[model samples]
Target: MNTSVVDCQKRLCPLRYLPRQPLSDPQASSQSASCVATSACESSALSFKRQAVRRSITPEFAKKVQSRSQVPVSRRSMRLQAIRPLRSLLHSKTTVSSALRPWGARGFASALVDKQVEGERITKVAELASEQAVRVTFEDGATAKFHKLWLRDHCRCEHCMHPETQQRQLDTASIPMDTPLHRLEVTDAGDAVAIDWDAPVRGTPCTASEFDAQWLRDHAYALEGGNAEDEDTAPYPKSYRQPRLTTQQLWAGADFQLPTHDYNKCVDNIEPLMRDLYTYGLVRVSDTPNSMEATEKFSKKIGFVLRTIYGTMWTTNPTNDAEGYNDTASTNLELLHHTDGTYIRDPPGLQIFNCAAQAGEGGESRYVDSFHVVETLRKENPEAFRVLSTTPLPYFTVDNDAHLATMEPLIRVDYAGNVVQFRHNDYDRAPLTHLSFEEVGEFYKVHRKLLEVLRRPETEFCMRLQVGDMMIVDNQRVMHGRHAFQGGDRALIGCYIGRTEYESRLRVLGII
Candidate 1:
């Protein structure tokens, strides 16, 4: 070692110009001393002074250059630089990088390593090579052979290809079992290894994360079949404990003639009609005249009828105010879909509305099946469904006058957990809980998606309710919104009914 070398000190330190020591000439130090003071006493004193001076200079130099005291390298800093170059490489490239199935963007590489290394994900793509050539063995004494091309097609890694979303996007149905390959290669990938197919098929490209997902799908036993898109099982009737409706005989008559003059039959039919509303979420009465008195009478009768048992359950919409009932305005517009009484823990069971004046232009009532909305969501946005089903949300409702309002999540599936219902009025929702922040964006995302799907005119069973038409619907299951209209004095008398009354009526009728 060159002890006198100043490689460690490029700074302007006083120690830089110090005299060099030669170990071999230690005995002749005084004799060869540059200073005239070569006596034993002077030599020893000079040596002690030099040693003290060198120590003081080195510390001062280090303090001056504190930032670069150690070698300019660190695990994090190196990773940062390493990550920078990968940013440009992340964009899509047309050619197959190699035969690893696309898994994820560059960022997922580390996660893939962690998951696979811990044995959390496994590979089930056995029968590595076949075509009357190679044999492959897997755990559980299973043995199979696949054409070399089959093994090549199963390469899982980025650079080879990547999945567009959370899971792999490859559809292996097109890959025939007879495709051949000359060789295959496997390379160490930090924790989980990456497979490289020597004969890179023109279309076979994948990212590293997709490789992990594929392995997990094949080996982890966690993957499910029959539409991974369908996430929530609860919305389906079988998943919930609540008894589903057995018969759908509300509109069985093909005559198209409305039920107008049958008073006893009409009132008798209310039980089954409202019961159908509960099971299906929405129901309608065929023939009632469009008159203010008739509609109000129907509304009042339903409220009064249910009030006998429901008590406060038949209360007016929170929109009704202390000042007085103001029923002048009309909801005959392009109203959006929404669930009723979202704010209440037990939302109103039945909603009664009569068409008092149907002379208005285009004020057809539209109803969307919320269950269908659930199915559509499950098919399209499974992750969003997961977020919604798992998260509790907030919702709000307004009094008839629109002056007072209450809030809760339109979909309340948690505490009373099994029952699915909504209290949606995008315009009326106010905060009800603040448990998880992730739900803020998730709630809005799901609501927006549902709204988009629900607004489709096809989903809405639109009907022109004349002056005499009265309808009773399950407030929880059905979302009622009206189309825009002009010209006529469009008005309807609306009222709420209790769940207990509605259920009792159903039992009395034996329609359940």
Candidate 2:
């Protein structure tokens, strides 16, 4: 047999399925079964190749091969004829061992099997190195050191985080600065990192809890100092910036039309609604059902309805009460521009109002972008702006059912000196008991100026909301009011939602 023919047979046969033989021994050729199998495989492979070449090659190539070939066609044909019996024996329906079957017939290839086994191996482990920190090692030989204080502060155990709400319960200040990790180990499956803390009482051992491996991976920070220049490259997402609007820019359109969507679309697909709320600070949904239940459902679609003294969902209509303690919203009187819940320390972040019945005349809704007003005040009168932003004002509401009092600056600025929240309500404001005589005079000066700017015709937009129209406003960024109506029945249902839940929905929808 030619050397090339033997080499081709070796390549064609599955190496694992072939019987072991010594390649150095020339006597190996005397093995009849192996020799027969090799010769049959070679003949079959050559036949398949010849058929492919005949179909694919041009006639000119066939002529060139016929003229240049040293071996006669008759000899080649004779060898093919001799291998016919062996080919028939190999192809016959006979029992074969599982090990002799081709690769992938019984299972995956060897390389793929190795890869899966490696992937299932343990990839993460944690060990207690000292009283100060725990060392975590990953599969790739990379390691991270987590401080004891950091680990205790971020523990997600039920005692640390509320099981139902997932809110943190542990107080950072209560945790000892010298808290020590007594024991640390990786779970057997390597899906979690378990840690045991040394309690003050030696007999009472702290319960062991597991931290998710992926969570640890996500929060891993480098122990070494990184480039200082990279810290201030871009602002974080939570950092506040002034709203992208001016009085002139917002009123440039023929009408101040906010982003509007159908009520059904707003409920079913909330991404666009969230985007609009983040951008314009207000959104309107048309054709809502005329009921308080519909308003509750609309608020729940984005976040839970915030229950206050007024209830989860409150109805506002003209009430003929002679009581002096009644809220301005309960009467059929024109309301000045104001945000709700200014008397609460943490006021509702979003407010929704749905018109269930239209007034016969003169109940136009008015809205002013507090962000734009703040920008104007900041530019025109920097001193007044500074006073409003820094000085806390008294806002209180006292009735038979509830007595709420809070002191917050009319304009709130974050650490970056960007305006974050605006809370103002002339009707609900209490006496300035905490400020001095000079401070009170300066505060009133700025307070009056802010209200003047808020009520300006160009600064506020007015619209008559028809029945079945709902408007959603960012209570922190926009102030709303209503015109007094006469000789008609007007009804509106309103609700509040927390800012954290609203922003969580936006994150889940990838709107922010």
Each model's C-alpha lDDT? 0.42, 0.61
- Model 1 over residues 1-512: C-alpha lDDT tens digits? 11011111222112222112223333354233312222322323323324312222223333333333332223212221222221111122210111112223222221121112132222234333433333332333233343444344444433233322223335566544465433322223211223433333444443222233224223322224433334233343321122223443222112222223333444433444444554555556656655545554554433443432223222222133333543212333476676665555666777777665664467777676666666576689876666656665555434443444443444556553443565556545566467557757667777678767666646666677775566777777667777677776666666677675555444323344
Checking candidate 2 for backbone clashes, the offending pairs are none
- Count of residue pairs whose backbone atoms collide, per candidate: 50, 0
Minimum summed lDDT over a 10-residue window in model 1 is located at 1-10
Candidate that would win on TM-score: 2
| Candidate 1 lDDT score at position 182 | 36
For 1-512, candidate 2 gives per-residue lDDT tens digits of 32222222122232232112222232343354345544644544444334323222223432333233343323333222222211223331311111111111111111101111122222555555554777666654556577777777766554554322334566767667887666677777675578787653222222444565534543455322223223222122211211122222233112567789898766545556767887777888999998887788667777778888776887787652444436888778898789988999988999998988778888899888888888888988899899999998889887758899989998998766778789988899888889999988888798888877777777777889998899998898889898998767787888899887676555333334
Q: Candidate 2 — worst ten consecutive residues by lDDT sum?
A: 108-117
